[model samples]
Target: MHCIGNGGFFMWWWIASAAALAVLIVVVLLSSVRVRLKYYREGENDEVDASLSALFGLVRLRYKVPTVELKPWLNGIRMKVAPEETSGVLPELDFAREEIRRFVQRVRKLIAHMKNYKRFFADTLKHVHVVELRWDTRFGLTDAAETGMTGGVVWGLKSALLGVASRWMSFERLPSVTVTPVFNQPTFRTEIVIRTRMKVFRIIAIGAMLVYRVLKRRGGWIVWLRVLLGRSPKESTA
Candidate 1:
């Protein structure tokens, strides 16, 4: 009887030990899961709570070309104004021709100014067509490899980018721009359009780091689990 009781006690102790270990593992897993959930929750909350000023405080002038290019060409037509000795008409055609001449001369000066900015000129003169420009912006994730958030790096990037664009168009010589405000959730983008006398092309600077910082907190555990399960993230394209 004593021997049986001792065996039962030992059996119960072993079962208890197994239960304790299982509980410990469960607790550890639950704690890890809780931490991750909290991280994602905090990340999402911060993203939602982020102000437009914070997200887009950094402004870049990505490209500034003469967005509008104008060339001077005569519309082929001649006006004949006649006021002979017998005719009592100071013909309106003469006034119209004079006004057109003045307009052509003004356009020539503007085109010359545009030429001083770019080395290469378009080899064609076409009719004035309005090519409507639209502003596009988005909120999304970018891989960390492609984006950066350092002040010096951004400054250098801004300088180099604008320098190249300046070689293409004289953005500084353009008139003042008016941009309409657009309020968006967590992100905002503004579009400005103007009827310019010169061919003007503009490139808005977009910062890669603007949205990258907000999304880097996901996937360590998921990555581990995938590896444990004999799977892995697919290799990214080179």
Candidate 2:
């Protein structure tokens, strides 16, 4: 009778452990999910505010990016996550803070690169004034012709800017990010926020479709078999 009791207890323990593990996995996956985004623009300036929530709103992240002077002029990023939200999932607060710092550094580097590119382009155009003048004289263009040429140049520039904007707006580096815990009593909520210009969900969908197509064409069964065997397809069969 004691042996049977012991067996039942062990079985219940195993079931309980599996249940807890499943719940933990679900919480972790949902905790940093992008939930909402709000965008506002005032003349040449724009701002984007986004929120990320986890565990059915038990954990939340909020961030704001205020583009003060426009494209290249970022007014710095402000992000905060509540401390209560970091209880079980996050191991340490220091690690989370360091991660946020690294992200800010990356943003600064990108901004600097953009500013340098703008300066270089402006200088190049200044140097080309003589060439532009020569072209104008050689063409003997009328006012209407000059206006058309200017319009074409402006259209090309607008298209190039749009292309760059589309690529930059895709948050390829960090899709969902968890912020460090802010210990203030009034604001003790774990937050994970992601603000992006382009529709990242759509991009992901398109990428997944492309990957599926490639895998299907290359024999999806072989790929699945290799994944189950814990071996890359490029590895030798031997």
Candidate 3:
């Protein structure tokens, strides 16, 4: 009887542990994820910073482009990537072109595996909330008239972008925007920051559904296997 009692205790312990684990998973999936972006440009210096954090920073990713003002015509563009206090430089234009090509190819592959990518992207992004947005720019030209004209154009562009962005996302707060025209000396500077938040569960759910649909397609698994093996779509075995 004692042995049976101990067996029952162990079984209950296992059941309780499983229940606790399921609760924890639900909490994590429901947690909020934050995305941030900062772009700065002053004179010839420009840089972009981006980060993502979730569960009070337990899960985080930091990405930055140290110098975005590379002169492609003078000495070829240089891209500085720094992560974990380490930096690597690559030719900016060439690297960007290759990445864009791969991205396009990936989109095409996804379309072949799971048709209707437009719907997924639109649906997923629509749920993303713009929690904060701030943009400030200062510009100047030797001529006052030119400076005024440019400032108006900049303001117009900012308004147009905000209008479009608002249609796609729910803005938690009105964007703080400013544009100053300095006519004394010829100079220009701008800074833009945006913060977004979304529920981790929704994103994961959508992505999982997309993956499930893709894997259900004919030979879809083989398509990704080739990609994993570093073989382009053109490569085939008889």
By lDDT, the best candidate is 3
Q: How accurate is candidate 3 locally (lDDT)?
A: 0.80
- Model 1: how far residue 106 lies from native, Å: 34
Expressed as tens digits, the lDDT of each residue in 1-238 for candidate 2 is 4455888999999999999999876555433333555555433445556566544557677665544232222333332323332333422122244444555654443333232345433433332211100001011123545545654664465456545544434323423212222222122122222332222333344446545543544354354444346554344121
Comparing 2 with 3 on lDDT, the higher-scoring candidate is 3
| Model 1 C-alpha lDDT versus the unseen true structure | 0.31
> Which candidate leads the pack in TM-score?
3
Tens digit per residue, CA lDDT, model 3, 1-238: 4465888999999999999999999998889999999999999888889999998689999977777654445354456666645545543433455555766786577567654666767777788999999999998999999899989999999999999988888899999999999986899899999999998898888879778766777777777677657777655221
**Which pairs clash (backbone N, Cα, C closer than 3 Å) in model 2?**
31-54, 60-191, 61-191, 61-192, 82-189, 82-190
Clashes of each: 10, 6, 0
lDDT score, candidate 2, position 122:
41
lDDT scores in order: 0.31, 0.41, 0.80
Model 1 ranges off by over 4 Å: 1-159, 172-185, 192-195, 199-238
Position 118, candidate 1: lDDT: 28
What lDDT, from 0 to 1, does candidate 2 have?
A: 0.41
